[model samples]
Target chain A: MNVAVTEPVAAAPVAERNDRELAREELTIARKYIGPFPIVMAAWGLGNLVCWLALWPLVMTGTLSLWIAFPLATLNVALCYLPSHEAQHSNYAKSGEPLRWLNELIGYVSTIPLVLPFKTARITHMDHHTYTNDPERDPDYGVKAANAWQAILTGIRRRQPGQPNAYGKLLREKAEAGDETAKRAMMEGLAQTLSFWAILTALAWSGYAIEAALLWWLPRHIGMSYISLFLSWFPHHPMNEQGRYRNTRHFHYWFGNIVSFGMEHHIIHHLHPGIPLNRNAAAYRELRPILKKRGCRLDGV
Target chain B: MIGKIVQTIGPWGPVLFGIGFLAPLIAQSMEAMEIAAPFGLSFVQTGLLIGTGLGLAAKFRGRWI
Candidate 1:
């Protein structure tokens, strides 16, 4: 019996097929959670404003104590970073929509307490996500590589004159390279920095220096330090400039997850930047098997 | 009913406790600033008691972390 020879169909490469599957799964999961994120952002953003308004009168009237105000203000300021982070990802407003103006507005307002220019921060943070753990490329490397104390000290040191660090240098280089986005970011950053100093000077000139120092400056430092530790040092430290999974760590503890607004899932974030913060836990669960199979490291509380 | 109450407060339990715990120090600071203490109650003692109560509730709620 003569059997006709049949041609075997060729299958796609295993790695390519797996990557496509992973992308599809991530997209589906991300789409499910993206709608609610803007609402959460608005709630938290407005909450921060309300807290500031309530506390500001008390602060001005000397009703709110430094001990209380410090922690509360610090927490508020730290929380502000989250909305700005969401805006940075264009997740605060829907993508390709007119409401994107709201995202930029929210980003700028949210970062005001921290004295961070939204444009500059957004660009630098995007770079951080793109080049995580890269000593040369990541704007966050100096802070991430240092211990908490060192990170704090380095932050102080970097603020001094003639002490341009990696981030600043990169910003300057990008501006010099005729990058319009970077140029606008640098201009905004400088303008915001100057405005902050001008306000502080005016405060001192008007004899509210003590109040400014106690209520504003101190809390900003505390908030900055808190963010430095949680976002930079804890998530990326002790990891080399390896590819995504190997370089970032995930936190399983609820406290960390809540306070960080689900940012504790840094590895998942790096692996899937499209996922919103509110759904990070769900995404983590969905991707946990894949992550484990890929041997990703888990860290932090 | 108790489980429902615990479920209702959710993660806010610790946050409320934390606020209550800070109230005493806040009261003292207000006193130093010559702000009149509200309601004639000892803010510190009151804050501590409220904090402890919330802390207990939080502990019961199992969301204190």
Candidate 2:
């Protein structure tokens, strides 16, 4: 009669043991934020664009001071991308839905001043989500760098003549394959570029160079850099891992959420793209426990 | 033809890109501020800048392409 003994084994940590349970719990919480049509985003899309356009006339006619118009221009250009971004994901309404026109309309018009074509942005953005830290595949992978200057400089470097462009290559491939949407994106992109140069050149010749430079030229460059810095680089720095949870990070932005464009919750956006930009913070708060359990890189939570 | 011109420019591609973008920017700034074009050839500068821009833009697939 031999005595049998239970094998000694270590028990899993509390959070580790409850990972599955927490995921299910997290989904329940996330579902609560799915939608009721965020009208605020629509207002932001239309309002910011109208304000950006109005800058031209106001400054051109000397009705408003360039000193004041400059800052507003930067703010408006930076603000323009988000609403279109929301519309890019069809956050307002799904395809074929009755309100879908509003989504398309907002997507197209909101980015006019920024000189980005919505279809181009949407397609490339979808690719970005699919391959966020994958150097070989992501159109946005060009922005990955060790620091702010590197990331920003890389953006400029990649735009230099004869440099390889990930976005362009991908769009070209898709368009060559006869994807109608991609073709439209390419055309719109060309059109936007011509329009930007034409307007700037025309204004310069017309004696409104200061107005053009302050209101659009400088602002667009600054705005693009700022967007690349916060949206692309900060949220996904050291962009090494490709795992869903590990690819993106939530870090403390000392500048606080608003000045940082609410990007501290960008990890939440990557995880749940359907959540409107404004709701990511609240959802992140509720889903923190599960994210931690999932071994995500939440630095400042 | 633009692509050929771009290739002919060779290593100066970026230089052209810079000049093409900055020439107009500077020329106009001078005009707006009522300063001279340094060479006093504002119209000549204008034509060259436009020509450079069109060349850069032709066969352009993306930014600075």
Candidate 3:
């Protein structure tokens, strides 16, 4: 289905006289929720270290069976990565500075690109919120470019107006307008893809070619990529009557929760971005009636 | 530290037990049932029960104890 191409609409300008006043008010509210950033940062970091170290031996030695490895590693990503996500939001720690540091650390160590600090992610994420589900302007919107074969076949088919592929249309608009987020995300994704492949190369250089191919290198890039894609993408596609609700499906299974950190409660998450993951269930329960009244419900797991 | 660890694992209790542990075991049990159609028991069934039982214990601990 073809969705309208949306451009970034100019934000309503804050009156110069009121902008500073509003900033102060927002800061006060932010401070009430943002507690001692250092303690939270230290605690989260320590907890992250413990979890990773706990898994290191099993993963390194290959003592755990492949099935166990799959689940454990996925869990590990949730534990460690959620903290990173929280850090990005500046919510993990009550303090802002420490959260920035934590996010920066993760950005560097994380295979993903360090696109921005907490403040930036928060701002950009908020922008995502305001323009959410907008097929064109939503930063995360875009389909994988069709492969050469598909592109050639599509050309031969000569798709009629309003019948062009959704992905092809999105790509065409993204290229023409040169969306900044799409460019930045592609750069980061490229960097991550290369860094991961480099590890495999290093292992080959170290004479553990076969082991690396089977273990760290292949599973993370190949298997983990597939897992990550499905976990991240499918739930948030076009799904609302207004096509505004970001596709967020919540699954109440342990594996599902661990895989996405209850991200499946995605609709609720989009509605209440500040609610901690740990508190989502309670919040969801409380908000259920209101959501139902609005005719919104969580979709597939 | 122990308290923190418990706290760490607390919020995830339902998921760890109900869905994560139980779902797989149920799947396995079904598979085993198919394999051992005439037998009194099957390895898959045993594995499923063991896995689910452990998960159920964890879940019970999380919710009640």
Task: For candidate 2, give the lDDT of residue A271.
Answer: 83
Superposed Cα deviation of residue A180, candidate 3 (Å): 10
The positional error of residue B39 in candidate 2, measured at the CA in angstroms, is 5.7
Model 1 CA deviation exceeding 4 Å by range: A1-19, A35-37, A94-96, A252-255, B1-65
- What DockQ, between 0 and 1, does each candidate earn? 0.02, 0.28, 0.01
lDDT of 2 by residue, A1-301 (tens): 0222233322454366555555456566666686679888899999999999998888877899989999999999998899999999999999999999999999999988788889999999999999999898888888988888898888777655678867778898998899999988877886787677767767765667667778887888888888998999989888888988899999888789888888999988888888888899999998887788788888852
What C-alpha lDDT do the candidate models reach, one value each?
A: 0.67, 0.79, 0.45
Q: What's the distance in Å from true for residue A268, model 2? A: 0.9
Q: Per model, how many backbone clashes are there?
A: 0, 0, 8
The reply for model 2, stretches above 4 Å from the true place, is A1-20, B1-24, B37-65
Interface RMSD of 2: 6.6
RMSD each, Å: 15.9, 8.1, 18.0
Candidate 3 structure quality by residue, lDDT tens digits, A54-145: 55466557676545554544444434444455555545444555455565565334322121233233434554556654565544333222
lDDT of 1 by residue, B1-65 (tens): 53365347533545443343333434444555677655776755554555566556655655332
For model 3 chain A, give the 10-residue run with minimal summed lDDT: A111-120
- Candidate 2's residue-wise lDDT over B11-39, tens digit each? 45444533444455666665656775545
Q: Residue B16 CA error for candidate 1 (Å)?
A: 41
lDDT string, candidate 1, A1-301, tens digits: 0222243322443244465454454455555554554677767876795786577668778788756876787777777787788888887666678787888788888877789888888889988888888778888877754465777776665543334556656777898898898877877876786577667646543445445555566678778877877777767767485786688878655465776656677676677665666667887886675576566787655
